[model samples]
Target: MAAVTMRLSEIGQQLRAFRLESGMRADEIAARLGVSRAALYRYEKGEVIKLDTVQRLAELLKVSPLTLLGIGVEYYSRPIGFFERIRQIEEETDQILQIADPVAYLVTSPDYDRVLFQAIAETQDAASGEQYASIMAARKSAYETRRPTMITMLPEQAVERFLLRGVCEAASPSPELRDAARRVAAAEISRIVEMIEAEPIGLQFSVVSEVDNTANCMLMRGRERMVLAINPFRADTSPAASTGVSLITSAPEAVNAHQRVIEALWKDSLKGKEAADRLRLLLAEYAIR
Candidate 1:
């Protein structure tokens, strides 16, 4: 199941590459296909490329269907293309607005200790010392070359739980394994906060009862915006699973609709000092200290 999902994701990446090489704009492709630009954008994002669209893209790119689908080769044998696209987006984005409910660290500038924090927070049993160390090293390397203009909206309850559990405390762990996890989480959270404070970025928080109701993150870039809506529980259970149904489109109307939704949410959100105060209040309520 993992291999299949990975292959499909790779194919999406290859399709995007070919589209770039062919010098075809998404709008041009959409016009040719008699669909909205947004629909074509969805195809590129690997949001369920239809069989017919796959055939058409193969015909257009001059690649065989099997090669594009990545069927005959090892799945991990190829590089993950979506990561490269993410890197490209980070480099090119003038601004980023991230809404994270369950976790707050994935898109932070100075990087978050995603693996260690996730492991500790999700498990009652401690991780191995080696596992904790390896995740920290990987986290450091991943953040070395990329930085994005970021605005993050996090739910209050998630933050409260994170702090109350001492997820960010250096003393939370006793054994070597738990200690390593604790240290990593504390360091990474501090680093991220510092980076955000030093940059011309925005970090906000709110108590949105509707946050969990919405099941995806929205990335806006220039005139192009990508909406990634995934079922969280399903995704957590199967980390490598493809988004069952993702809608990626560059149609002006669709993009406008998403933008409007984002704007409305932002307007209702707390930013700057207000956001910090709210966070402090929540932390106090949870007795984080």
Candidate 2:
């Protein structure tokens, strides 16, 4: 995550520097790219750059793609930079705020049961299953080592759909897939509710409204933060292709902005007993008694 963020930021800064050096305004660049000035601003701010756009920028700026990507000679040869940074952040986070359309499970944590993890894995494509296992194991080790605080905000409809239907309507395929998903979803939902009820490490769960288009789940660890946004193309077809970008920052302003967004969502979401009641209603609607 840190690697991704650092690279993007570096690239963004480099783009801005080059643009200024060329004595061109943002509007001029936006006009050339056929994008709005606001869109260009987002790129300059280091939000997330598309691969094609990076290529175009490299061509336009007369810089190598690797340099634009911040993949300095040494780092480019390594395969572990991205995952290693994620592990480091997990170990260091004092608190984590997770906002995801579908739930984000720390597989090794008590928050998720092993059976549920396997069930979810069964629904994945072969490659996804392999990746899931590796991620689950790594997350488990991180949880055991760090024991950071966790708060999760999920979309109300997703919870309702999963609990009432006993499966993720979005992930369903054939009848067999539906059944497998249902068993896993029900059990995982129950486990999650129970964990929240226990309030271990001040854990909290809430159902937020108006999250339909939100596909990313964020994890904030002290001065560092990571956001994993789902790849729609991957989800629709090859589960093994599930890809996301993780953003990391120690910048006070950036961290504060993310914290504020999480807090706002939390305030707008259901809380404590109210949240539990909502979960129960869904369970009853699904006949999970």
Candidate 3:
């Protein structure tokens, strides 16, 4: 019975993930499933789910039955869904192994959110403002409360581009807004330098030379499972990004491979005072440009 409950709980988590990816409301799904909304929420809360119901849900959510059974890949085309899923994973994560250019969203400066919201507002509809804000707040709150150990690898070239282009990637911007964006970018880099110098516990940041054909991904190590998310949607770089599909999987081989790659990169990457000094020099050289 205990084993069955645990399996059911995992299936519930997968159901929630794919449901968000499906972009279908609870009531809508309930109506289509011929079940009460309360019942649908109960399933998400880990109640025993019938096999027939699982088949119906797989059909409605456009995912294979094996996926809901927690044995298949989870694909997300919507950035909102992907980010929300990330938040869910991070909630239970013990540590995060991340490889992204510039910096990961969790380590970004506080002001980064405002700049990001503005850029997203410029590119996205006003209807999505509330949802975006909620997700942003939830992510920040989860990180603050959990404080998971994070090891991030950032590329030097990406940091250079961040300083050169600033945070706002909107198509057209007023001169004053552009200046403000650049200032924020410089401040963010400064914050990163400070972090590198401080060498805080449970937080590791390394800067590596730019390499060709690298993917943005993160591995979240949890108490029971390790999940890898290969994401192309970057809020810091491009707020209105919607072209790429993010892949989330718990396959051991996939997780092991990414972990190995991160270890290899960390071995040759610059860290501590050396990384701080390099970033400071980049800041000075790029501040004038």
Candidate 4:
């Protein structure tokens, strides 16, 4: 049936995602599974997959069988894997609805990338840092080319904190890095203010006081499917990619639940001049400090 074929296709897609996250080569996985490399590639291309094979692949991939089958949540503990998954989903997305507490990385200026790299590069070796840089660049490029309709809700308290601590809050940062971080924060927030005032097509920014959460939640909607990602890994905050677990799911129930929450909070969010003025006040208050 058509329905069964579509389900297989989704499962194949999930297989590729988990494979990327696991960092295992297709030939290696195929060898372990006692299948040919060609067969593994075929499975990833939506060929028929046996239930027992799904179970074995789940074990090999370190994910639950339900997750492999697209029937349960996809868990990601590494920020690189999580963001890479997001980048993959965004490749096909036409609309993005997000609640990225302080600001969304997509709207941030280039200087923001420099600040982020400074934070990540501090803890990583040269090679790992370069890998992270590539992922960031790829994400930015995907957004530029796709130009998805994005509606983002930001928390006011989070913005205040971002202005206070800057993007990278190292345990003991040098004076120069601290100052640069604050300057980048100010510039990034000012850019948000400009966006609010401009009301650009296909982009919307709203500052909300009630949503106190710092986690990033996004619903990426494509032509045939939508994905919900709840990520604790923040690009701005520079949290270790390994420290926190993220949830990615496509179940209708979970999607509907998160949609309800977004809808409720969006009603009370401030936009246009009101939002811009609020951000300006924060900038002034922080600049005086």
TM-score (all chains, Cα) for each model: 0.47, 0.57, 0.88, 0.84
Top TM-score hit: 3
Off by over 4 Å in 3: 1-7, 168-175, 237-240
Residue 28 in candidate 4, Cα distance off native in Å: 7.5
Per-residue CA lDDT of candidate 1, range 1-289, in tens?
Answer: 8757766876766576445434456678777777898887777677887778788877776656765675531111111122233333344344556555434443433323444445444443343233333433443344344444455556555555454443433223455544444344344344434443454434334334335445445454643334232123211111122334332333456556656766677777765555545655554465422
Which residue pairs of candidate 4 clash?
A: none
Over all chains combined, what TM-score does candidate 2 have? 0.57
Residue pairs with colliding backbones in model 2 are 166-182
Candidate 2 lDDT score at position 153: 81
Q: Comparing candidate 1 with candidate 4, which one achieves the higher lDDT?
A: 4
Q: How would you encode candidate 3's per-residue C-alpha lDDT over 143-249 as one tens digit per residue?
A: 88999999988888878888887875543556666676778888888888888888888898888875765678999998878889998876553423468898998
Relative to the unseen true structure, what is the C-alpha lDDT of residue 195 in candidate 3, on a scale of 0 to 100?
Answer: 86
Report the lDDT of model 3 for residue 245: 93
lDDT against the true structure, per candidate, is 0.47, 0.56, 0.79, 0.80
RMSD of each: 12.6, 12.0, 2.6, 3.2
Model 2, range 6-72, lDDT digits (tens) per residue? 5667666556644543435678888888789998888876778888888887677565687567663
